[model samples]
Target: MEAWLLLLACLLIPFVVLLIAQRGAGKTKNGSRIPPGPLALPVLGSLLWLRHSSADLEPLLTRLFARHGPVVSLRAGSRLSIYVADRRVAHAALVERGAALADRPPATRALLGESDNTISRANYGPAWRLLRRNLVSETLHPSRVRLFAPARSWVRGVLADKLLRESEQAPPRGVMVVEAFRYAMFCLLVLMCFGERLDEAAVRAIGAAQRDWLMYVARKTSVFLFWPAVTKHLFRGRLKTGFALRRRQKELFLPLIEARRARKDRISRGAGAAAALKADTTFEHSYVDTLLDIKLPDEGGRALTDDEMANLCSEFLTAGTDTTTTALQWIMAELVKNPRIQENLYNEIKATTSGPEEVTEEEVNKMPYLKAVVLEGLRKHPPGHFVLAHKAAEDIEISGYLFPKGATVNFMIADMGRDEREWQKPTEFVPERFLPGGDGEGVDVTGSREIRMMPFGVGRRICAGLGIAMLHLEYFVAVLVKEFEWKEVPGDEVDLAEKTEFTIVMAKPLRARLVPRSRN
Candidate 1:
């Protein structure tokens, strides 16, 4: 009996040793290593390791990268969350193996109502291709973007009047520029969407309704991330609020969308010439009209329902406004803090423009320094720190590491732009880096083959609105700089501390004295 027991123990000991070794290395049953990360606690997984909500993850992600190197994994319950902070690796995997990293996380898509619609959240398939192509080709194509030139020019005058009214008060207090930025962007997008320049009250109502929905999305809707089957009981109230917010958006947007549809219908019924004369709004083309016309080949050849149309319009408005506001705030703040850079930019604008008579949209292209400043602002403070999470379509290998299928992938946009290895004085704000003979002179924002800095993400999922976004930023910043000196308030210093909302915004809203240089 003793001899048999001893032989059994010796055999079992080696197998136990192998199991222990693999577990120590964090290897899966298939002997694949998920990237190095903090050990997960049972049930909670790595939730305890996180210091804040997922939206505001810059600080938490920064620490994780430092501890575990560029590629790290965090287990969110049963889901594996993988983060890639290194830009070189990001380009190699996301750009080269775009298909593998193209699909979105299942949970995120379902939660965002993008499961089968919306270009940003649609899965990788025929529907996605159709929606993306429509968005890029029909809605925001280069030619269509030029059609909004009148709207953009109008917004500049509105913004200037706002800054003047806010600053011309007693003693020139800090004029909170956040609202102005948001309003201007909302006006521009609303006009592009409905082909109408609405009054201030109507625009504000639309902005407010959209903001309510965005607030629920960014703040109150955490339970959606969990498996709904399990959290349904707990999250019922929040989900109801989410629905109510959706109804509010439909209430506001349905009217605008319906008006567009009515006009389109009249034209389709052979009243085309007469309808054009009677129409209250005239857009060379409206995005809503484009949405109304889409026939989804994947969804049994159905046109978008009124609800879906509302959601898309909401998405169009929210996507354009919040981000532009954030970028404008940052650019204006930097200009306020660094007057010397502003002066140089102003001088460049003056040199480029023919005496600065409101600086027409066509002339904006000639101002390189203004473009450089906008690009630098985007690089330093990208609207989104991480691209919307990408999911691996299959078990993929990159640089000797395994990224398993069904895993969520994210890249650190802020970290990539600020990588000390790639940028000189990475923390400082300098627009010249993107100018001629400068550090980032020819750096490509698009990661076609290589990614230097992606303020708008790269890969097939790169922002469809990239061209319009750049034009909007460049045009607005140039108009503002030409109109105002944008000086820091008396005894109040400029603060660039970041706070995450829908986008990364200044913790203290940008407030400065707007000294008019030229009247629009």
Candidate 2:
């Protein structure tokens, strides 16, 4: 069945919207570290109180800090959850005790697949360490990322073309191109993963199917996280549907995997036909190459299972696409609402691109204003409200607080972004704050210096795609501004309110009117 076919089965997919646990859902444990929170329920835990919005989680986390304290613990039935809002606490756990706290929470096992210790979902283990090392050295290395330039450019062209088509006969209010952003991101990631470019229609079909599968998995899997047996029996239909969705993913991906393997074989034979393969700009480079090339330690000196490769491939595309696209939407909305800042940024781009060749990688690295704009946006609206949950690998103490070994620890990415002590006028959208000589300026976002804001996370499990994400953001933002002048449609003010899924995104899709600037 088509992935979209399952869209009508939300009734069966009750797990999608309901399993999310609220930040302050339950009562606090009487002893041990952290502060206080709401009361918990049996089995369902504090998740019963969570609303539909993940974007709302961050603001709620901020509010909870005010009401309770910086560090608060909540009881979700038998599970004890702690929310660390203070920078010091965050630094203590994520940085100071980095290795000891690098394990992913055990709750992630269901979707993380069997054993759950791989990149992203994997816990701290020999396998995870090997996976992370292999990924950094092989697939996501700076050199490998450089090979993706053509992919980025292709998607950007598609994005610009789509915007142009939408604006051709504008009826006044800026066209709402929110879905365009998602599609572009999906296309880029798809090409990156499959290493082969598809026609626009194929790209759209793949993107739509992927989105459907993701939405379903994200929503339904929450149930399995907290209450295993009861949810399994109660939501049997959802479970079946989930299985069907996974099968659908296999249908879409398995073929691509097979084709890539065939292509690799052809090239290995020194076939002249393989030489006819189109330019780097045309044919997509499969991420599978990296996976196929790297030998995992798990196969007992043999190759990894198809399932493991699938998980890694899916994760590479899904993680980067959703979060980056969501961040793109938020950043564009910020530009639309703040035109002066947009113009200033445009001027910076104009200066860099005043000559002939398109903005080079080196040139992009030099744009302080553009860098600040992205940093500010990331700080204001982090992709994930909190980094993926980190577990205490060993009992550790920091700043008089003790986090027991194996405790699931979460840091507030949004709270740190808006921390009043770290950022001056934290609520305002002041890109200048990140500029030289400004408050919070000169702060390193690389997480090497304490944890103030971590959108991609910190320490051992920090996003492997961090470099690629930054390149895409800066490149697209620069090209986007150069291509058209963005404005806020009068009736529709850009709403900064956030919504949640895997990533914290704008509740309402961004709708903006694009007027092309004189290219001359």
Candidate 3:
């Protein structure tokens, strides 16, 4: 009986999709046409898109863009997805008309577990505004970020130690640094999330939980996005696995959250703020602490539930860790591939700092070449190939094409940075372009005015952690250069070939020979 029902639902879905597509097809709002692309079939929107993996989708989309202009529309299942490859169109839609295009498409609640409760996944509304403001002001604020300086220093040591130890152990082949980079980032983000300098064992447990949940969602649960009602019944085992992953995340994170809650309670009871601060050896502010304090006005001044808090913390950890780690790996790989650029950056670092101390954030601010190196990394290889998909909250027309309300829109992040029109030798890793009197001089990455390149996105929905991410990149890159001379292994040269995971990472995880520099 169950198999019969499943077969019947599958048979009915195509007609249902056709009915919806016909209703929206050739529909115009205010004398505007929807972007043109290959016609979507009855149930499967674009057969090429459905058949190709995201890694292979780029070449397919490139051909589609060449044929059907920069802005193209394709239907997949019941959803209309519009991909904008033009920078001007992206700026117009994401910046000039941000509010109309700021919202996120609805996510399957069972797949996400907490629905769209976290900031990134939440719809653009008062709740989003409140959550975003809380993060930017409370934890990610510069003043608050300064409080975590000691934490960054500690993580840097952890990274350096790991690399050094690994290099020693694997003398002939060189060390694979992606896992080290990831672990270091996880350690730092875990500290910020929980406000505890957890032991290595505890950090590894938390990191494993977060990574497991993220990989499951990115790999397994995305299938349920289409016809979730029907697919949920069909893929019950996978659905259960997703839920189990969420449960594992909660199990790892909730204890740390509750501990923070207890600390807050103790301070409230009578510990006194200064004394409480003194008693706790870790950083003063944490993401959890801020979440505990936020009262949702839209939800009648209610505090966030434990599940909601865990999800948010999960977002905070994954957001800072994966993207940053990916970017770091790409940047370091570039350094290994390009020796002259590495030496130039090392010279800049040496000129700025006198001794063998970890590069301070204040000192990193002064190194212009270091900044340029990091900027070029973002342009040449953005962490994410596409920003999170944006939904059209209302009818938004860009370049005379109508992006109707309820349609999903996304910008090609990698395409814009490599555009020949906006950049000179866009494919090359030339950090000097961002130096004074160069093509990319004074380039605003935020895409506030005009988008030369948008690594952290642009406008209202720009990444909340942009400032801190840049800082981490600069500080770590500067110190890493100062501490070691990165060289390509003789047989295994650094390969820039990329594979898309949670972010775009080197398909060959960077393995490079590290020669410790002389301090004296």
Candidate 4:
């Protein structure tokens, strides 16, 4: 019966898709100035030709950007979707008039499940403000981040060891270090989140659970995100898969969260922490501890649920790990592809420290070229080509386009960074461009005043993890570069081809040879 139903659905796929597409929906119903985009047929707006997945839509969107101006308007299902590729307009909207564009779409709730404490998906208001504040102020604060030094230092060694093992185990062709980079990042973030340093098996278990669920959220369940009233009823299969993934996530994360809660409870009394983390020299508090104490203002001053805690903690782990690891691989690939840049960066590192004893996070601050390299990597390829959809809180106008209230809007992050107007040789990996007197010099990453390149986004809803992310990229990239000479394999070359998943990543998964570099 299920197979027959699926087969019937498959046969009706084309008709169903056509019906879901609203061709005339993109028309200016109010007769106001609207952004120009591809013309559409009724029942299938411009979306008739596009797929909901990022990978499938990337090329189409690129073509759309080239056709329409920086701002393009299209209708997806029943909602008017606007894409912003212009940095100046993005600045005007997200920075100058941010309050109106701060809310996320309602469909983001699909990922949160029953949890509402997630900062990334929460609506723009007190609940969001409180959760984001708890993260930025208590957990990710500069002082609090500094306390994770032990975790970072530990991961540095683990990363080096893993890289050595992988390189040695590589086939004659080469080996892919993607898993190593990802695993190291997970270890660091897991320790930071749970206040526990897990082993390879345990770490991979948590990471598997996370990646499985995120994959579903990013692709499989996105159908529910567009016109959920209809998709919810029609897409029971996707929802069922999401629920199963959610269950597995809870099964894996609950014990961890519960353990921490128990420890916190014990500490609340005079019992103190169960001496489990006694050997840890640093980090008296964990991110989960911060989440446990949070009392949402909008929720009648009640504590967060386990589901909510899992979401927040998982958000921290995945957001920090995946993005940073992608960055590390990209930076390393760039260094391998361009040995001149790698050597120059190495010399910069040598100049910063007395000798080649691992690069400390503090030393990371003084390395301008290193900073520039990391910045350039982010510019060349931001994690997401586009940020999370930002809903307009009110009808706002920008760049000669009418933005309807409650419409979905997002910026083209990759395009803005690569805009020929703002960046010269936008796709090249030249860190010097960010140095003084260079075209990319003194580039404002925050996008506070100017709308240059904002990888972490800008305005009130800017990434709360921006500060710590920067530190991770700079610190780990420094350590990786300082320790080994990343070389492109003879038979296996580094392919810069990009594949979009949760983040736009190197399609080939960054295979390379690591030769230990001498401090000389």
Candidate closest to the true structure, highest lDDT = 3
Number of clashing pairs, model 3?
Answer: 0
Task: Write the candidate numbers in order of decreasing TM-score.
Answer: 3, 1, 4, 2
* Candidate-wise lDDT, in order: 0.82, 0.74, 0.87, 0.81
- Tens digits of per-residue lDDT for model 1 on 279-390? 5446757889889889988779999889888878888897799888888889889999999999999898888888747888788888888888998999888888889889
Q: What RMSD, rounded to one decimal, does every model reach?
A: 4.9, 8.9, 4.2, 5.7
Best by TM-score: 3
- Clash count for candidate 2 is 20
lDDT tens readout by residue for model 3, 2-92: 9999999998888778866765765565667889877666656666665776446668789899999999887766688899999999999
Q: 27-66 in candidate 2: lDDT tens per residue?
A: 2353344345664444445553565343244566667778
Candidate 4 C-alpha error for residue 221, in Å: 2.1
- TM values, all candidates: 0.92, 0.87, 0.93, 0.91
Q: What does candidate 3 score on TM? A: 0.93
Per-residue CA lDDT of model 4 for 7-26, tens digit only, reads 99997887656544543333
lDDT of 3: 0.87
Stretches off by above 4 angstroms in model 1 are 1-32, 41-43, 47-56, 107-115, 277-280
Error of 2 at 407 (Å): 1.9
Residue pair clashes in candidate 3: none
